[model samples]
Target: MSGKIRACYACQRNGRLTCRRTRLGEPCLKTYPLECVDLLKRSRVAFQAGRTLKEGFRLAQLEAVVQMLEEHECGFVDALGRDLHKSTTLDECLMVSEPLGVVFIMGNWCSPVQTCLVPLVGAIAAGNCAIISPSEYTAHTAELLHRLIPFYLDNECFHVILAGANDLPEVVELRFDHVFFTGNRKEGSRIARAAACTLTPVTLILGGKNPCYVDQHCDIAITAQRIAWARFHNAGQSLAAPDYILCHTDIQAQLVQALKCYLIEFYGSDPRESRSYGRMVNLEIFNRTRDMLWRSGKVAVGGQVIEAEKYIAPTILTEVVESDPIMQQDVFGPVVPVLTVNNMDEAIVFINKQEKPLCVYAFSKNNEVISRLMSETSSGSFCSNDSVLQSLMVALPFGGVGASGMGSYHGRYSFDTFSHRKSCLLRGTRFECVTYLRYPPYEDRNLSLMSWACTLSQRSQGWCQIL
Candidate 1:
């Protein structure tokens, strides 16, 4: 209505939204947050044009993501460090691979960049338009993505939505072709429910209290080092990180000592001062972790907390009962509780009693012990003699089961998650007369011939092996 202001003509004309903004004399530096309707319109238009159906286009977009990662590697690392107090020296990285049509991806603050972009890659590969709604908890990384994604990706097909609390209400109300979310069970359930309202299919990459079973036959030293590195690397904020340990009582004391030794070895005598050690992502997580730690159990190894710096030492709690506060829920922090079981059977029973986990890690030299656990468990994944290492293998699917979450993605799995698997069957029309053998009269000779035709035997043991 004034010289300083003008209605958002682009949104008004092309989208089901009315956005008014001021046209400053100079280049406007402010990012105008796209309305839910506007974001949907752009993606829908791209989807209808079949931009995603081109295999060449999908491959190019995938290449572009790799280029984006390589070109802006330092910037992403810096943002991760700023947001999660991540250690740059740590060489480990996590990614989830997938794609979908006019998709909405809601990432978590824990592994902000990886959780968001990995799925985006899958979506792109599957030839789907996407709107990435990054976690507000990691504001800096979100801001960087907002600026960088458009520069590398096809702007008409991809978008980064960054807005305040009020923006979310409108988002869940809009319908999407698919919704991919990664976060806690509570929030993940909420997102799934919201997606259901629109009759939209959803793939929830959720978190849970994954268990690590330490058998007496395990190489305690190696197990300890691996657990310490895996659990505390990202301040224990990883969804797949071992949440707690169920150790054989015979080796519980020694296992605790070994774990203590490794934590100090990996981080330092005081992890807070160690450059390799990480801190809590923010004050809210710090406080939640502190409370969980306080009520968890007696701190057997490290128990220091510096809330001001959002630091929680790589802490292990012993003398923890199965009914303890920390044991009952997912402890997504640098704090793990170790509980002792009389034997492998006790450990198995304890694990079976709880909700299915994302992963169940067992460390043992005994092949039988490993086999038993593998057969008995019902997790999305299980790793014997290792911890969360399978996630790095792009060939393997990364996801959870039951209460942990549903669906999976990584490499081919990611591509499949975003792409519909339509079954196609083709038959020769010239063979119509032959089909009458099994119809109408349905003679015993026709049945015999049909059965014989379908029957076959193995050519070799390679074709059919005894389990």
Candidate 2:
């Protein structure tokens, strides 16, 4: 292994050093240190090649890849759980099914199953190579992915680099044709800047403060049950899950009571003992959630904490103001803040005041309420009379708008993201007479004759009505 590592370094140095390193000597790897020029060249080649291939071919290839990954469901779920400490089989399929190009940037919060599988599926379908850089925080998942990816996919085409945060700039300098990043807004901004140097295309899926609305007419029992399920999923590590709730004043207490009952039913009185409930990703996230709980306005229900296990019970707070810290940031944890408003219109206004969220959930049976929310507010997607189920629909496009995210991908959208459309125009050989009249050289008499002929044709066809 040591000899192979040395040879790999030699390869990076353009073979300046000759070693007695054989194929058995640690499997010397070659690194392609791509630059802006390389990126432009590759993009041009990909665009031309892609134009020739039919979209149907791309879609079929991606579907086959997703099916293969799904077959190894246990391997994927285990890798994610080991890396992120809390992930499910469902999360693995949801994250990995949408693939991108060969190389992509992913966050620590995401499991290796998602970080590697998602872009792997996309890149292979697009017929592009990838350089994957997993998050530093999730070292175990990163290592597992670095080890397992070569076994599942072509090793030469897919490369995984585990590096420190400071090394990201050097890595980004490689000039990928497309940069697909999933992380916080601050880091996503840095990635955007780095990709901007080469004018490379980027798809950023960043953080969100998604709001859940509970209307007065909503069934309190069903609304609370759904909210509890969404808020506690993966300890609320999801970007599209409801971060806060906006309820009509008339139903606030009823909703709160129902929420309390559901929490007990789902996680029990002692949530730390519940196997279904998950913990925060790490100590830092636990501390952040703890601080938000302390500084919040009022605790409505489920404020229990288990610091050792990084567990914060499915918490709900009331009287949360716009200025509060919990309300201001993307509360990516098991805490749900409830704010009361007079009516549905006021709820829409409140949501519009903030940056667009990745998802929005409205618990209302009225068709008018659903229509208004869908048409008036801008979001990545929305779930009517429920929460988080929109993400389960593989057929629908999933992503955020404005500050939340830049592009979307899911199922067919994944194929579209990786493929470029080429326009073609076919001219007929039989239309020779009409084509001859369009030639440049012409005398005044000829021009007048052509104009008169066109006028007659137009009059005969009733062109005025057509115009």
Q: Could you say which candidate leads in TM-score?
A: 1
RMSD to native for every prediction?
26.1, 24.7
**lDDT by residue for model 2 (1-467), tens:** 12222344554434333234535565445433345334545666776665426667789888888787789878966874564453211101112233334456554564446745665566667667777778777778889877887788777887787887667655676787777777777777888888888777788877789988888887889989999888888888877789999999988889989999998998889888889988887888889988998899898887878788888888889988989999988887899999999999999999999999888888887888987887678998988988877876768877779998898776776566665554333344554544455577877866754553343212132122100
Displacement of residue 296 (Cα, Å) in model 2 is 1.3
Superposed on all Cα atoms, model 1 deviates from the true structure by an RMSD in Å of: 26.1
Model 1 lDDT vs. the true structure? 0.80
Runs with alpha carbons beyond 4 Å of true place in candidate 2: 1-102, 105-112, 164-166, 426-467
Error of 1 at 128 (Å): 0.9
Off by over 4 Å in 1: 1-100, 163-170, 427-467
TM-score for candidate 1, please give it.
Answer: 0.72
**Candidate 1 lDDT over residue span 25-110, tens digit each:** 44333333455445667888998887896678999999999899889989976875565452211112223333446988888888
Candidate 1 lDDT for residue 152: 98
